[model samples]
Target: MALWILCLLVVLGMGFNMVSGQGEDPFGPEGGRRREMVPAMFIFGDSLIDNGNNNDLPSFAKANYFPYGIDFNGGPTGRFSNGYTMVDEIAELLGLPLIPAYSEASGDQVLHGVNYASAAAGILDITGRNFVGRIPFDQQIRNFQNTLDQITDNLGAVDAAQALARCIFFVGMGSNDYLNNYLMPNYPTRNQYNGQQYADLLVQQYTQQLKTLYNLGARKFVLAGLGRMGCIPSILAQSTAGSCSEEVNQLVLPFNANVKAMLNSLNVNLPGARFIYIEIAHLFEDLIANSKIYGFSVVNRACCGIGRNRGQITCLPFQTPCENRDQYVFWDAFHPTEKVNIIMARKAFNGDTSIVYPMNIEQLANIDIEPN
Candidate 1:
């Protein structure tokens, strides 16, 4: 029965792509001459925005096959969502083609941008160690350095540097560091540090990481703060009444506060750095609290997976997803459906100061880069 559903999903995706003229450029005329909001986009994070960088890795943290991309035009291109991820929508809004996965990208594909997000990855190397074969945040930065070298080889060093300055560097990470590492019993992180202390350690490391990016010519950045981790399907499932774990939610508040402070400090110290913090916690809470307003009937249940809330287990190889995919906020045990992803991306692109503090992506994109 599960296999049958999987087959149907693939057929549906293929048919949709065929009818929608997916191959043809949806942005504009030929020669990649579309008017873009930014020169390019460099993505760094986890599965929430991973395109297909994990497909070739010897890792269990993969979504390269089956119902993963059941609603996407390309079909199971390793995005955890049933369709496009937030980054995909953000790219479209920026008038650029979807950023290619760094592992599979080359030639002109790298010109637009590259995604370094890996499923199960985190800010710390040991955060997702249980998954194995994952690229930690540090490695993702190194990969970006390699991409910079490649860009320099193609365009001259001066032009490549200018392009880098004009591009957007988006980072949506840290969730797995808390969820997969600190919370897991097998890990010694919890034994070493309490909630506040752990958050401090993570932020301390994160500060250096963003600084590294700044030194590497990343000027425009969008750092997405951790959302309401307790409200996620996986966390809710841990409760007998399916209520959110306040303890888990409280753990993330400090991290978010620290991240905001870090961004403010970076902006002051880095001179040219323009870092925008996306208040994901508030945005996610609004969606969950006012599901009906967002046209979602099921805010807690996942569209895929098994057991209560369809979250006790993740979406398996042949699992059937929900029929009304748009009604559910989550696509799997850990990720949001494409519908919600689009909503989040739209808000991050042009939302008010409450959601995107200081300025939104559209405002940041339009800011002219003044050379040092």
Candidate 2:
């Protein structure tokens, strides 16, 4: 009995380490700086980067179960990443816990932040319907407004406004609008309109959507632009005998460039409504150009299941899993590794945003506080 107890304890100890990040935060904001007040972070987007809203729905793209969270959290917490996501990292920077998924019943526990993002969702509803019945961006807004009302109804309008005014909203979607929605289906008018025209329509709708959110009290926005989809294992597999499709790259460039322009236009329109774009293209490119520099040994393969898209072919209850997940750069064909999301999130806030705009999430969150 004594020997059995000792062995049980040993296994439990290792399990605990795998969960709660071995009781240590990989990116705990302790590099000689930290925020004073906690800021709310609201997120909206798709599966290439969902933090768990899809778990609420009956979809295959969902990532709210076991084995998915084996790396960092030890158990599944609905996050799409192996553990934490970009939104989680951003919330940590603000001294807040991970943002709750909208599908969760405990949004009130972390009322300051909530994620309406669903895996496979997109800017347009058509894109979401392409893969699964995802919560469209517009519906995500409805959920956000409802969440605000929940706080206001209980805490009163003044308190709710005060809570939201200091909030930070991060939007990281649009890939599906091109991938599953416009380009893939039977030739539609949008597809024939050329990349520039298609991007314009997307920007117009996106701009209108953000304006609507601002009207509802969104002050700060961190928009994550199109990630490196051309470099995805799935897209690469579609090429001639395992090569990256340059055609995919050709399609992605115009959309990304247009997003930058539209973001600039939105910032110009909204006063005191600061906007920052998280450039994911170059980030992924770095992973390919120099893998060691970005901490990814395998730049194009996924770590789960089997086949080109990493079990996406037969991704179900009985698929086989890869032995070493840490060796791969992707968790699935479309999404990134948990470690990579951390790097991208850190760079988004601390690196170029500071240089590109002379301000960042760190500075904005700490604007009202005096240095200690």
What are the per-residue Cα lDDT tens digits for candidate 2 across 1-372? 121121112111111112343333322356233432444577888775566677767666666665566676556766665677777777776776666676763512443466788877777777756456578899988887765555345444444444455667788878888777676765373646787788777887888888887876666777777766777777866655666767777777887787788778777777667677777887777667877766567777776645765523422333344656666678766677777787777777677652224366666655442111
Q: Which stretches of candidate 2 lie over 4 Å from their true place?
A: 1-37, 153-159, 186-192, 309-315, 318-320, 353-358, 368-372
Predicted structure 1: lDDT:
0.83
Q: In angstroms, how far off is 51's CA in candidate 1?
A: 0.8
In candidate 1, list every pair of residues with a backbone clash.
none
**lDDT of each prediction vs. the true structure?**
0.83, 0.65
State every prediction's TM-score relative to the real structure.
0.90, 0.82
Question: Positional deviation of 2 in candidate 1, in angstroms?
Answer: 51
* Residue 194 shift from truth in candidate 1, angstroms: 1.2
Worst 10 residues of 1 by lDDT: 4-13
TM-score of 1: 0.90
